[model samples]
Structures are given as structure tokens and as C-alpha cells.
Target: MSKDTIKCKYIFEEDYNPLYVNGAQGGINSLGEIIINFYLERNALPKSQTFSVENGKISKENIDKVEPKDLKNSFVRVFQNGVVMNYQTAKEVHKWLGKHIESLEQIIDEQKDKK
Candidate 1:
């Protein structure tokens, strides 16, 4: 090996945790850079809950918060994090996503032909 040669390895921090998101919302800021907030969407949850016990095997539960009448069609979006990037990075990401999306569509078509 040459004297100037070097090797490198990457490792995640101790607090590193994978996040799952299905939604994104944001726009540019005063600096003109793009701002994207990733989030997860799901049914709305009760604001609070309570329970009561009478015997070793007897119990009851109660939800203090009254759910809206339209709760059956209600939903919630919980933002996990946000990322900021310049126009150049956004264009690169756009191209990369388009290529991958086209490939995925082709794969699905091929699978359908096989069936």
C-alpha cells in the first residue's frame, strides 16, 4: 500500500433509529431553499383513556375524550422530521427517483405478463 493510501468505514450513532413515513409537506423558506417535512398518517387516536378494575379478572375501560361524529372518516398526520436542501440537490433527487420509479413500474408489468 502507498504511504498516502487510506480506508474508511461508516457507522450509525448510538441514537440512530430508522423512521417510517408515508407523507411529506413543506415549501421553500426565506433563503429560497426547499424544505420537506416527512410524516406518518393514520387514524386519529383518543386524547385520553381510563380504566377501572373490580376483581382479579373483572375490569372496565373508558375513553374520557369524546370522539367527533365524523371520526369514522378522521385521520391524523404526525410529522417526524424535516430536511432542507438547495435546488441542485432537489433536481438530483428528482432524477434519481424518476429512474427508480420507472424501473419499478417495468418490474410490475413483467410480473403481470408472467401470470
Candidate 2:
């Protein structure tokens, strides 16, 4: 498989909609960049809103605040066969991707040694 053909399941807010996204990996040096960029792009929205007020305006100012971005809900679940992690724990799950890649490499090396 080409490096650019990494397939991953991206879950939107509250697991409402799941989309299959393909990101291009810049070889082994750029293993996790794809998912990291995806997370940033997905969650980098304007969370805070602004309002205007007039002089001594005493109207009902009950502004509704938007909920925080659910990082856990919006994350890449897997990256090809090298990365397999849960999406609930965003940071920890992505962190495990490195270890999983290393483990896969080690297993591949061991298999090659046996042959």
C-alpha cells in the first residue's frame, strides 16, 4: 500500500457521524502527522462568540454558550494496520499509535529473522 492511502475512521461529535478519511503519509517520517493535522483542522473552530452592547442597554442578555469541542468524539480511530487505537481517549489513543507502530515493526523484524 502507498503511504498516501492510509485509511482511518473519523468519528464526529458525540459519535453522531463517522466518516472514512484517507490521508497521505509522507513516508515513515510522517506517520502520525496525518491524524494530528486532521484533529487540528477538525477542532480548530471558533469556540468563543462575541457580542455588541449599546450604552446602558438593559435588555434580557441571556446568551447561550456553545459546548466545548469533544476531542474524544472527533479523532482518528486507526491509521492503516500500523495504528490501532480507541477514539474515546484522544491524547492517550494517539500516543499509543507510536508504541503500536514500534510493536508492529518489531514483530515484522522477528518474523523476518525466523525466515
Candidate 3:
């Protein structure tokens, strides 16, 4: 599929839980970016996992409070393919990438069958 034609979906904070907590902000943005990059690197269309953030403008101060390391760790979960890859890690992410590619291939096959 063309890169430009790849489908991407985003689930913002409003769709799940707020990213900010008592004075500490979560790493949703960084996590989201990581997920998108993960899909792009493997040539799979990006699909956002469900999440929610509160309404209102997120300030620089709040964003600054987010921990980058924590966000990266959290993003690792997306790659766990529910099999031997039960934990989030670079290896699991690669496995997930493979799964996504297979899924896309299946989709294409199904489309062809319908024709």
C-alpha cells in the first residue's frame, strides 16, 4: 500500500482517561508517537489504541512533568502479541510488527476474494 494511503486512527485522552493526575502529567503523546513510528517502520498502517485525556488546553508545564522513560515503557505494551511475547520489549515489538503485517496481508486477500 502507498504510504500516503495508509490508514491511521487516534484515540485521544477524551476517549479514555485524562493524562494529567494531581500535578503529574502522563506520557500519552510520546507513547502515541512511538506507536505510530512502530507501525510506519514495519510498513503497517497505524491504528491507535483507545485512551482518554481530559478536556482543556494541556500546558507546557503539565507536559514537561511527563516522564519519557515511563512513556517508552508503556508504549512497549502495544507490541506484546499475546503469545510467547507476553512482555513489552524491542523483541515483542518486532513480533507485533510481524503480526500486523500478516493481518494486512490477510485483509488484502479477503478483499481480493470478494472481487
Candidate 3 on 1-115: residue-level lDDT in tens?
Answer: 6565667898667556422212211222433322221211122322333333457643333433444524433432223111122225545687888999999999999999999
Which pairs, if any, clash in model 1? Answer: none
Error of 1 at 99 (Å): 1.3
Runs with alpha carbons beyond 4 Å of true place in candidate 2: 1-90
Model 1 ranges off by over 4 Å = 1-11, 49-73
Computed on alpha carbons, the lDDT of every model, listed in order, comes to: 0.84, 0.50, 0.44
lDDT of 2 at 31: 32
Model 1 over residues 1-115: C-alpha lDDT tens digits?
6588678989999999989999999999999999999999999876544566677653554444345545556899999898999999999999999999999999999999999
Candidate 1 whole-model C-alpha lDDT, 0 to 1: 0.84
Among these predicted structures, which one has the highest TM-score?
1
Query: TM-score for all predictions?
Result: 0.70, 0.26, 0.25
The 10-residue segment with the lowest total lDDT in model 1: 58-67
Name the runs in model 3 displaced over 4 angstroms: 1-88
RMSD of each: 4.8, 17.8, 19.7
Error of 1 at 105 (Å): 1.0
What overall lDDT, based on C-alpha atoms, would model 2 receive against the true structure?
Answer: 0.50
TM-score of 3: 0.25
How would you order the candidates by TM-score, starting with the best? Answer: 1, 2, 3
By lDDT, is 1 or 3 better?
1
